[model samples]
Target chain A: MIHQTSLMAIAIFLFFASTVIGISFYLGRKAKSASGYFAAGGGIHWAVNGVAFAGDYLSAASFLGICGMIAFFGYDGFLYSIGYLAGWIVALFIIAEPLKRMGRFTFADALDSKFNSRGIKLAAAISTLVVSCFYLIPQMVGAGALVQPLLGFPHYVGVIIVGLIVTLIVTTAGMVSTTWVQFIKGGLLVILCTIITIMLLVRGISTAPTDANGKASYIAKRGVTTVELQSMGTVVEPDGAWIGKKDPVTGDMKPAPYVRIKNAAGVVSVWRKDVVKFKDGNPDVTTFSETQATYTVNGKKNVNGLPRGKGEGEADLKPVGYLSKLPNGEKETGSQTPWGFLSTMQKSEAILWANEKIKDAAGVETTVYYQKPTLGSDFMTPGSSPTFKKVREEKFFGKLDFLSLMLALFCGTASLPHILIRYYTVKDQASARKSTVVGIGVIGLFYVLTLFLGLGAMTSGALDVSDSNMSAPLLARSMSEFLFAVISAVAFTTVLGTVSGLIMAASGAVAHDLASNVFKFKLDDFQKVKVAKMAAVCVGILAIGLGILFSKMNVNFLVGWAFNIAASANLPALVMLLFWKRTTKQGITAAITVGMISSLAWILLSAQAYKDVYGWDPATAIVPFSQPAIVTIPLGFLVLVLVSLFTPKPKDLAAVEKAS
Target chain B: MAGLDFKGSGEREKEDAGVVAHNTKLGVWLFLVYVLVYGGFIALAAFRPDVMKQPLILGINVAVVYGFTLIVSALAIALVYMKTCRK
Candidate 1:
């Protein structure tokens, strides 16, 4: 109800983001030399780089997406934390030293090491731009989301302001400012999150969470229409006519009852009462009366638009726990352990809190059923990642979807060009390795704390179910206004850290690789740096626009697309070039191109895309409904194998330069 | 100059050397490689949990199995690389 915290949070976050921008501008003059700008003269300590790794790695997806997931779904959200931290191993053991031992500024530099093909430079640069831009979208959107509750600013304003600020951070100092900003953000983010988690443990779980209205707000989704009560609950109709239920035997009009909230004691009750729906233009100002009775679930029935054809193992989407169960007769654990009461359904299956009146096939008024997530398995269940929707309504399939998402997250990390570039910022392979270890510790700690933060939010009564993104900040709001302001501000910077790093990588690719080598521009080192700054501005704008466009998509899900693209396009070519000597420029080129294109096409044509982006019927999407990794990663390897065999090996680097 | 031979070929070397004053770019690429591999493992932790889950230490999922294995293995790789690449 208050936009009070928003101003303070915005002011504080702006102060932080802008100060970094000023520092970058001051330090960035030195970065005008290609070596300095690209790698910070390769003198950064592994410790600093290590924390910077956390800054770059902990994107909007990690903060908002993971917190939102944990808040809404129990234990399932922590799975993301574990998955994200695991990807560092691939970078540490498999790719680290050899990659350092290989090439220069871009992933293309390492990739084009042997062949010196312009094709390699061109392709890798393009892939870097695409993946970096994709990743930037979520960061920008996350910035906007945090700003809304924190600063009370409009969504696009948050997006635009963050974009401009990041552009300033990048164009001024390039990697120098980018690194320090991330360094500060990374350190602050983890420490603050750790504090929040501790507070959550101390607070424990509260059975009675007071609302602003001082009355329990009962909400029900009736078909397409939603009825929410300020005090109890309100019901409205589609054609503007309120619907009332008739007594089955008495043939008399009876009002639907909301939960007979008994809050005199500290714990609340979930008893049902009846009231007739009466309308006078504004249906909200109406009265309710008790039903003077209680009803049990005679038989369970499916209520959604589900056409009941599948069996239990096939489609038994059951609820997890009762919102209100009676004492003695009802099995009660701690009122807040979401998983313990998950298996049993409550005695009262349906609580008819409110309904919406809609036109039926005959064009007459009809009422659609309104119910909560059932107690058995349906409540606290995972929803589809756009028809990547596995059997989440069931147990095993839900776990598998969780598995699939984590799989992408882990593999996606090492493959990212921006993160890979950080390895080069530190001196020597040893620093690279040690820096990573520190990064793991920092990132791992933050992830573990996310579980507490999420669970805290889930039980925090402050959650707005309509927007899962609000889980963390809203949870903070329940604790204290000041904590909410700080956490919300930190979350906005979290977007700032990742997006700036991503833009830096994309800019370098365009200026350093695409313009200089591929197009053969004979520019001075200073000119190269100038081009990079311009590229940062361009990439920053694109990121902001896409962030606003995809404002509504879940931050976590949007990141999955970035991961899928990075793993497909970048990893295959990189792995082959390092391990297999037979790899020609043709093969590596084909693999990278194929991996990037195929994965992008699959995700774009994906059923999830059909549902989310194109608004098509999900069932119409024909791919085997799976992560493209199992197919695309290997395809990249295979294309490299086949193309390398078929095409003539390009001239060796020594001979080519001699010829030139 | 003696150890790196700044201008000399290794046991086998390519002749296209544009030797700058420092080894800045090579270091950056190596860092990039580390970042990618690190990212890959993070993805694995997310995607494949059991592989990373070592015994819980003080109720904390330290990712000990993954963490220890990574440190040890990275050390081993660095050792082998230094040994083989010595001039």
Candidate 2:
């Protein structure tokens, strides 16, 4: 896909990125001390911190991935929004005030607050690094993904660019700049998305060019028509369609088109295949391509990539929202109320796009999109995704997978190193609680807007079926180029805000939690800040490297794994320390170590990993399901409890005593 | 402990401690409610997707209504937590 660089998008993205860097340098003076660098001098207003919390929490996964999921899959995508927002309740009610009161810089501070144990510090610092790195991969991946469209840069170049920019932001002012950056980005995201949702509502549902009886109308052709051509091997028909090349071995004409394909290893190959019909009786058609012969004006084809309406593409993608029937038996319900829109859509026809990998006559594999007209209610229901289908089947492992993922999402927010650190940004426990409430409100509202943004994009005819992450941005572009530029720029900032926070957490874990506290490095405040800056640079480079490596995975799916790890590693100890009087430092250490290792191993060995990362049969995986939180979270709590019961009591018991 | 009392007022410490205890009890109770509601919703989604697809008052299904309700309830509970716990 050769992306055309839009000057408007470049200008807007540059403006936002530069403004963020300027703010960082301006705030650099305040970050001279370790305390200031790690915790923003603990003086931010609760309200601003609250919005910043939203900003930090709403990463590329939330904005790009979830919207893309909803655009492609329907209600399944919005499930992520609900699960994410619900996590804030844990942050607010369980962790917020306690974390604010106990911790100074990192999540380790809270655990080690009672005993000041080096073992506890070491375990927690490792856990923090693991979780932060896991989370960082998706953010960096999203950054790379954004650059392809916004800057017309290659994926690795985008990763490097984001890494450099984020490192600059973090090394300059640390939390002060990070917090302010999040605040602005969060506010803009929610406001702009809300405006987009309103625009979608006003535009409402209309007849697509395909739906209307026009030159490009496919309304008459419902199911795919099977066409067989004469066995013309290696022949280009007068109609411009390529035919199968002759097999060298058999000297027989085979109906397979030969095309060159580049694999992940960057090796180009011409793969060979012969057509074979499946038992289902469907023809083994490699791909479907209908040339826009009628789209020519004055012997010139229409401008490529100028959207469906004006381009050589099949139909004009108009505002398509509400339909009257399940599939095209139409009484058109035009514009509707928010409630009306959803209700009408439930009974309407939704033209969803699906893709399948096809091997041409040459073994070269490519994905092609085909329209699948489905009932709106069916599209809006669960089980549309292959991941969630087992739940609907009432399968035990499938249900467990669903439950574990949800549990991780519900528990992960409070445990995330970056989010826990935000509690320290506010002045006091009261401010922490207040900010949490505000964060929940802001984040919740934005999640609601995602439902509209996604569904609007679904029928907006602007979907790039090949890359689901670009759904929301393409939806914006369909409206106007200017809006698309602004949306893309803000989405890029979304990546920057999140990656910066993760780097900050990783750096704090290394320098403050590990070096100064755990290893007893006798570093002064200035030296600590210096060490942290160096750590940030290392972590930033590592994130960029991993981002490029995991370029194929969806950001939302990657975030789910991050949540599972965070919940498994951190939640049990934090909850136990605060609520249970008997929680020992040894227990916290053991729990963190065991929980982190177990969850990480479980994910690496899970079925999804076997299929996606390792390219093996999922059935051969050791774990029954992919998500690890259901098993690991309980294991964490059990380890903490049993260890505490067996271990000697802490000499100080300050945390328990204070609670009593 | 000494560093914790930043304001250096004994009365303030006592009041702060009292607030913490009060907030803890309320927070725990509220969290239980949230878990029950949210957990129940997830259970329904997993076991009975068909039930979730059933239309509620509007043509809107049970899933959308419940999801929106959860969002609204989170905001409402947050406000309630702040209101009752505030000094």
Candidate 3:
């Protein structure tokens, strides 16, 4: 797809970036001490910290990935919404208040509060770094995805820009500026999405969506075309129409949905074939269809015969995602209530895009994107996408994968280091609980609006079939260029807010837990803050590299893996430390070590990593299932229990009993 | 300057151990209730997806209705916990 560099988008993006950096500089004066830098001096208001929670929590995965998933797969995307919100219950009810009472700088502080063991510190700190890096991948990938269309830059360049800016933000002021940045962007993301959803409802669903230029954004046609069979193992059609091929083995005629054609200019292209039946009995007529694009990859570069940008002869990708048939054969629904919107979509038929890679006998590869007309019932169901389609399969392991993912998402939110540290930004346990309640309300509202945003994009006629992560921003562009610019800028800030928070968490772990506590460093608070700043820069660079490396995977799916690791590694140790009386430092350390390694090893050996990351056959993966939380979480709990039972009681148990 | 003041009024009222215990008890109960509801949603989606496809209320299918309910219920449960738990 050809993307034009928009002056408006670039201008708004600069404005947002400058304002964030300006806030960092302004707040930098107060964050000189370690407390100020790491925990915002525990001074952030409950409400502001609450919105920052939304900002920190709603990374690129929630906005871009979930919206893109819904646009592509329908109701399956909403599953992430539900699972994410559900995880907050664990935060509010179980982790928030107790965690606030225990932790000072990082998740390690809370875990080591009881035993004060260096072993627990080392285990928790490593887990924090591992989970933060895991979470950072999706945010960075999202940063790259936004840059492609918004700034008209390459994916790696976008990742680098965000990496540098976020590193600056973290190095300058730490959590104080990070909190405010998150607060502002969090508010903007929710408000802007609400506005888009309102416009979507006002505009309503249409069978034929039009671009801002009033051109029909989707292509759907049927007409008979002549085809001439060639003798030299090739098929020819005068108008580049799709033609059937004779099977080499059976010598029988077979319909080919996509046929390779060499045009009069000798440029090879692929055309789609559609067999249409009319009421007048048109003798099984065939018509030619326009394919989305014929993508060619030579080494690392993608070259399309079509134009790249908006030059004089440049052409953009055809806007897709239109309803093939509206309810009751109406061309459009003028306006809709929220429920009316769902009910209307229930009875409609949508034209969803699916792709297939074809290699001709000459070994020339072409990717053909075709439209499938799906019933609204099936569209709104859970199994529309390949990721979640396993839920509908008969195999138990298929369903187990879906169950494990939901479990991970539910448990992972409370265990994330970045989120856990936010509790310290507030003053006391009460503020922690209150801020979490506020976060739940704000985040829940945003997730609800995602359904509309995703469904709106699904029929917006502005989707790039090749990139699903651009769905929301592209949906905004379909409405107006100005909204698109604002949304894209806000989306960039969303990444900025989340990445800075993750960096803060990682740096805190490095300087405080590893350097100060475990290694018994004699550094003062000032020196510790300096070390943390240095650590922030290093982690930021690492995140940028991983972001570029894992560019092809969907952002939300990567987040799911992060959640699995966080839940497996951290949740067991943290929960047992709080609730169980027999929990020893040895047990906590063992649980953290075992959980982290088991989940990491499981993911590396899983089919998903083999196929997407390693480019190896998925069947060669040793793990029976992709998600590890279902097995690994239980393993963590059991390991903690057995280890604690065998280890001696804490040496401080008597002093603690006397004090109580 | 006000935002920089690390020690705020929120620190003045620390809950006693009794209050903390009571809140923990209340929170655990609420957490269990949400777990059951969330587990049911996951089970249906994974095992009984046919049930999820069937419409339960207002012409919307069970999957969407249940999914929306989970989100709204989380907010509702949080609000209840905030009101009832002694913080």
C-alpha RMSD values across all candidates: 12.2, 7.8, 3.9
TM-score for the A-chain in each candidate structure? 0.77, 0.85, 0.92
Cα lDDT of candidate 3 equals 0.86
Ten-residue stretch with the least lDDT total in model 3 chain A: A229-238
Off by over 4 Å in 3: A222-256, A262-269, A272-289, A297-316, A651-654, A657-660, B1-13
Model 2, C-alpha of A648: deviation from truth (Å): 1.0
> Arrange candidates by lDDT, highest first: which order?
3, 2, 1
Docking class of 1: incorrect
lDDT of each: 0.64, 0.79, 0.86
List the candidate 1 regions with Cα displacement exceeding 4 Å: A1-5, A210-404, A649-660, B1-87
Tell me which of candidates 1 and 2 scores higher on DockQ: 2
- lDDT string for model 3 (A1-660, tens) is 666678898899899999989888878877898989998878788999899999999998899889999998899998999989899999999999888887788989888877778999999999999999989999999899889878989999999999999999999999988988899899999999999999989988888888766777866443425353121124444222133456767998766676555555444444566777788877777656556556555542232345444565444556688888887889989988999999888888888888876555555555677777789899798888988898899999778888889899999999999999999998888789999999999999999999999999999999888888889988898889899989989998899999999999999999999999999999998999999999999999999999999888767768888899999999998888878988998999999999999999999999999998889989889999999999999999999999999999776666863664
TM-score of 3: 0.93
lDDT of 1 at A602: 78
Cα shift from native, residue A151, model 1 (Å): 1.0
The candidate that achieves the highest DockQ relative to the unseen native structure: 3
Candidate closest to the true structure, highest TM-score: 3
